[model samples]
Each structure stands twice: as structure tokens, then as C-alpha cells.
Target: MTQTGASRNGLPVEVHHNALLQLLTNSLILSHTTPYLSCYDVLNLAATSRAFRYLVYHTPQVFRHVQLSNVKAAQFSIDGIDRGGETWRNVQVDENLTEDDFYSGPLRGIFSSLRRQNILQDVQILSLDGLSVTAELVHDILVDPSFSVRILSIRDVKNMNERKLRAALQYACRESRPEGTPRLRGLYVFGPKEPAPELLLKPPPPVPVRKAAIPAPPVAKAWNTRSKKALKVALVEAPEPWYARRGDQFPPRISSEWAFTLMACHGIIAFDTVLCTGPRHLNSPAWGTVNIDALNAADVPHYGVATHSLGGCASCGCAPEGWTVWGEDNLATSREPNERRTSGSAISEVGRFPLLAPPPVHSSNIKAAMCPTGQPVNPRSCFPSSTTGKREKACFIPRCFNCLRDRYCNGCHRWWCETCYTGPWATSPGGHGGASNTGADLLLGVWNELP
Candidate 1:
């Protein structure tokens, strides 16, 4: 083990507590040495002794980026964990106390005091890792004095009523007032295999006309049969298949080969990325760059007004600019309602209601998208024999690495359905044995940079 000390003749010299404190808190020491320590390291030092704890606890700026990893539900309380606040009666109470205050206990009182006094008010980024956080805690930490928190992260949190957290944050955003606290700007929520809310599962928009027409290239009959046979043989030898255990919850297919191909193609569940062994790559800096301003800007025509093509109006028999003619056509078309059931390919119209158009996704239904759960595999594992999926390259917003549903990696310019080669905006590769969603964690900095 490595040791740090100032020793004479291989023996450490004893120093007075006051002298040690002076040395540790010296201007040169803090500026030159403390900067070398990470927030985690500083927190560890704070736990070592009272003097160190006093310095670290009071100095919020030094530990601006706080990460509570795998923190248990029991630790959320400040009652027995700290001896700082011994009496609730002695604590100052203003006229704002409500009737509910009488029923609350010491921990709530401690949190109330912390908020009233503005403790942790300067913290910029707060990451809540694990599922132990309660709605009450969320409500307490995100209101008034604690509202300055800019980025709030929830990782691998399961069994959480996300609605409560969302409600609390919405309230915080709406209620920041007299104190002028900054509302939270960025939110990151990720889970390993959690189910998403039903609202996000809107049937994927009717397969567009262009995509429905593209047919897969023909393959030899013998090759297809051989692939199916090989897949069955492989699956028979493997451990319990995830599909068999999950029942019809996963994508449905008739044959074992088709099942394997469908899962691989859609990337419903991926263990290959998690099980691969190699050195992890560092995130590319370019992932931080995004034109959010342009994305959110009102839709605008790229061409100049004069450059627009002219067309003769069918009814008026006069040359009109392309946009004006288009607008007229759109207005005329708008008067006639589109048929809920349109004439299209068999697959395109499947599973849609014949009586109603697909409803728009409202603001309330969005939640974490989850990858399908499946059997783990090693690096040498192979897919169904002779089954090759097409490479997808288009990207979308709010992409997720776990579930390819309705999203894609913006930085990689590839669909989230792929199994390899993601940019920094995607999930962390498994080689480092760190969190699988490191990209989401790093997103705090990117979001905080926004105007």
C-alpha cells in the first residue's frame, strides 16, 4: 500500500490538531493540492474527522458536482446519521408552518431547516443514483432554496413513481419566485430494464410510403431453411431462452431463427455490448455540440421567395409562387378529413384503428425507454446462421441505447438499433465496468452549457 506523510528517520512526527488544520486549510495548499482531488475523494476526506468535516460540510462550492451512488433509503434521513441538530424545538420556526408540520418527524425538520437556511443552495449538479429516493424527498430538495440545482440525474432507479418527481420539478419550475432561485434546466432518467409508461408506446407512425415499398433482397430457399435449422439447434443447446420466459411480452415470431433475427434487427435486448471484453473508449468531445436553437426554431423554408418555383393554379388558371400554391392546396386539402384507414400495403395498415387517426403524443406520457431483457452472451456468440440485418443510419431526438424504440444516436448518425460503435451521446461501452449510461451522466455538462 502507498502512504502519504512527512516523516523524519522513517517515523511520522506528531502535529497538533490546530497546526494540522492550519496546514490543510492554508491558501497555497487549497489552491495547489486540493484541486488534484475529485469530489468523491474530498467527500471521503470529510468523513475522516471532525475538523475536516467542518471545513467540507460548510464549503459547498468545493464539492459542486455531487454523486450519490447506490445510496440506501435509510441514508436519506439526517436524524441519527448526524449529531448536528439535537433538538427540533430549539430550531427556529417561522409563521409559515402548516398543520401538516405537527405530524412530521426529525428528518423532515432537518430537511426543512436545511432548505430554510439555504444549505446546498449553490450546488449546480445533483445526481441521484439508485431507486431509494422518495417523492417527499424530491419535493423537499427541489423547492425554494434548493431550486438552484441545474441538472438532476436519476440512474438505474426502479419502482419509482416518476410522476411524482416530474410533478415536483414542474412545481419548482413554475414556483421559483421571491428568492429568485434558478429552476432545474436538465433532467436525465435511465434504467436498465424498466418498462416505459403506456403513453410512449404509441403505435409507431404508419410506416411511411417510401419505407413500406423497399423489399428485402431475395435469398436462396436452401439457405433460409439451413439458417432456421442452425438457429433451432443452437437455441436448443443454450440456456433458457429469454423469449420463452417472457412469454408474448417480447416481439412475436413463429420460428426460432425469425425470433433471433427480429430481436437482433430491432435491438430489443442486447447482451453482446455488455459482455464484450476490451478497453473502453473515451467520449468524443464533438458529442457536446448540438444546434438545439435551430431544432427548436419555427420551421422555415430554406429557399429565397424569388427562387421558389411557380405553378398554375388549377381553379384560377394563374401562375402562383410554389409556397402560395402549396398553401392553397393545403387549405383545400384540410377541408377534407383524411380517412383513418388509408389504401396501403397490408403491413402498413396492420394494428391501426380504422375509425380514428393516430393521436399525437402529449407532453405527459414520455418516460424511460427500456431494452428488452434477454440471456447474456459472451464475445464469441453468433447470430442465427445466414441472418444478416441491414445497417440503419438515420438518427432521431431523445435517443436511448437500451431500447431502439422511436429514437437514435444523434452524434453517431446511426439508429440506436445497432450493436456497436456508438458516439459519446450514446451509452457507455461495457469495457470499463462503469455505469452503462455514462453518456447520460455527462449530458449534465452539455445541458448546463445551454443558454
Candidate 2:
């Protein structure tokens, strides 16, 4: 190779390359080196140099856990629009583009770029919740011998089923270096799921009997074993007990794929919406309580994470930053250019404020890392009122997303207050034929309201 003395940065090309190679040799991804940052930065870094791109893609040691959220194949069509003619009609002139035609055509070509570069194996958190994920796709992504994915998130994949999910989970959990060490941590799906068979285990086998010969004495048995060892024959190994992992329940119903997911994971923050769908108890073998119903049925993976009864909510995970301060359009523009952030870094810390009482500006505001999730307002009131008076304007009131008290009223189903919660509602349920209900002084504003 020609020794390029120096490049533009006042450093030799070899020096720069060697420096990067050394750094890359070490872990590029760590607890603090977020997957979101690395996945985005890799594209930028890869674009800078072919050497870097080759190293990033080809180096099996350099792994990255990427997130692919809400990516949909592009669809285009040509139309014959004769607005000037009689009826202002519109007609289609081209065949509609299908998934087969444009399967990886979204999110700034990130999906296609990854596949084209042949680095799908580096993606550890696969969130293809917007596409028609199939058994084939899952196999290609996680079932490979060199794959490093831990958790998978999927949405409405019409071709997929719970049985397929179980198979994928079985393959993902097949790491046996130290026994029962699963590679895949969990599976997050929010789509059409076939019913998981509640009863997955077969009946226990009948006990074997020594029919013909009498059992040898202990010392004689040891002597016979020593004799076999002296013969240098491969001994038939005894099977490991299932009771260790599956447990000793009379009929282990929790041994389903859903249960296996929880079993594999070590621990979770109370805020990971993608995985923490419902009462996801950790560590214990009592996983019969968890199921696919915990996930959303009508939306993408993170989009519809309902507030879990076990102290979590959908708001904290999927919602973009500057959530409360900016309008929807403004929030869209203000989101970090960084790749998606998950509950990967969340800890056990949460607020403990009272309901209807706003938190301190420093703690619960949108500028900081948003942690506060809604709980249910007590005594659930539709706020029925009776007063034939001049109505007020729709104010910008801050209410929980779960209740949606801001834009829901008995009359027109609309209410908003910039500063007031109980000051003469614009439209009340009382004027109409409604029953008596009231709001409770909530604790830290429960969706403690997760129920």
C-alpha cells in the first residue's frame, strides 16, 4: 500500500485508520453509548469513508442494536385528474405499489441501507412493527447462528401467528453455554395473534421398572461403573430435569411463549412500554398471569402501550419529547434528530406527587427526561352540571390522556381550561340526563390510573 503521508486533518491516513480500528476493537456500544446514537451515527460515519463502512458492516466484532420503528414501504400512483372537465373526476392510471415491490422503502432509506450493506445481523432490537413480518423474516433476523438480537418488537404482520412466535422464541432462547441462558430477552408484538394453547405440556411418562434382573448392591454398582469407565465407552447421559426451568406446577400453563419471554428477561424498569405491557412480574416462575393481551391490538409496537396495572404507561415510551409544551406539529419538528430512545436506561425512580396538583416545574416539565405517567382520577366524574348561563370559551387545560377531560363534555364532548380545573365547565353532564359522578384527589395523578 502507498504510504499516504498526510490527509487533510494534518494526520496520516494510516494513523487515523489505526486509531479508529483500535477504538472499534473496543466496545463501540456500552450502557452509556446508546443504541439510538450509534445506529444514527454509523450512517454518518459510514458515509465519510469506504474503509469505515467496510469495517462497520463486515466486522463481526462491531455489533450494533438498531431500532426500526414505524417504517412503511412507499406507495406511489399516477392518476388522470380532469378537474376542468365535466365532473372533476379522478381515475387511476398505474398499478398500486405493493410490499414485494417496495418492502424496505422508508425512514430515509435506513431499512434498505441496512439490508444493502448486509448488516441486519447487527440489529439487536428489531422493531419492525409497521411491516408484514413473516416467519421467514423472523428467521432471517434472529434465528441465525451469528445473530445478536435480544428482544423483537412487531406490529400487525398478517402472515404471522402465535405458534410462529413461539417457534421463533424457542429458537431465540436456545443458547446453552451455561444452561437455560436465552439469547432473546423478550418479544413485543401488537397485532393479530393466534390463541396460544393454554395447555402446552404433554402428560408425564410412566415410571420405568427393572422387570427381569435384581438391582446390584451400591459397592457392586460402583465396581460395575468403574469397569465401564475402564472400557472407555461413551455413556448415555441422563436427561436434565424440566422442573428447573418449567417449574413443578401440577399443569404448567405459564410455560407458554408469553411466559417464556418473561422468564428469560432478568429485570425491567417500570417504564419499558414495549415489553412491560401489563403485570410483567420478573424473576419468579409464576408467569401464568402474563399473555399477548398485554400488548396493543390496533397500533404499532410502542404506539398503543396502555398504562400497565403494574405501574407503567404508554405516554412515557412512545410519545416524542417536548410533548406537553408544543403542539402536535411543533412536537414533530422538535424531536431529537437522534435515533429512537427506549426504556433501555430507565431506573426504578418515579414521582410521588398528588393528583390535580401539578409537579414542580423542575421535575415533571417536558424539557427534562419525562418520567411521569398518568394514573386514574378518582371517583371518575363526567362532571354533570345544571346552569343556564353564558358559556365560556374552550380553554387549554392540561388533563390526563387516559381521561381526555380536555376535549370531552356531556353536551358537545369538548372541554379545555388554560388554568382552571373546577371553574364552571363550559359544557357539563348535569344539564343533560346523566348520573352523578365525581373526580377524586388523585395521588401523583394515578392512570395510579393503570387499572
Best by TM-score: 1
Q: For candidate 2, what is the TM-score?
A: 0.30
For model 2, the local distance difference test gives 0.34
Best by lDDT: 2
How close is each model in CA RMSD to the real structure?
Answer: 25.5, 30.9
The true-versus-predicted C-alpha distance at residue 261 of model 2, in Å, is 6.9
Candidate 2: worst 10 consecutive residues by lDDT? 350-359
Candidate 2 lDDT over residue span 118-175, tens digit each: 6755655555554545564565555454455555556444445557655655555444
Clashing pairs in 1: none
Model 1, runs deviating above 4 Å: 1-6, 9-54, 72-119, 175-182, 191-451
Q: What TM-score does candidate 1 get on C-alpha atoms?
A: 0.31
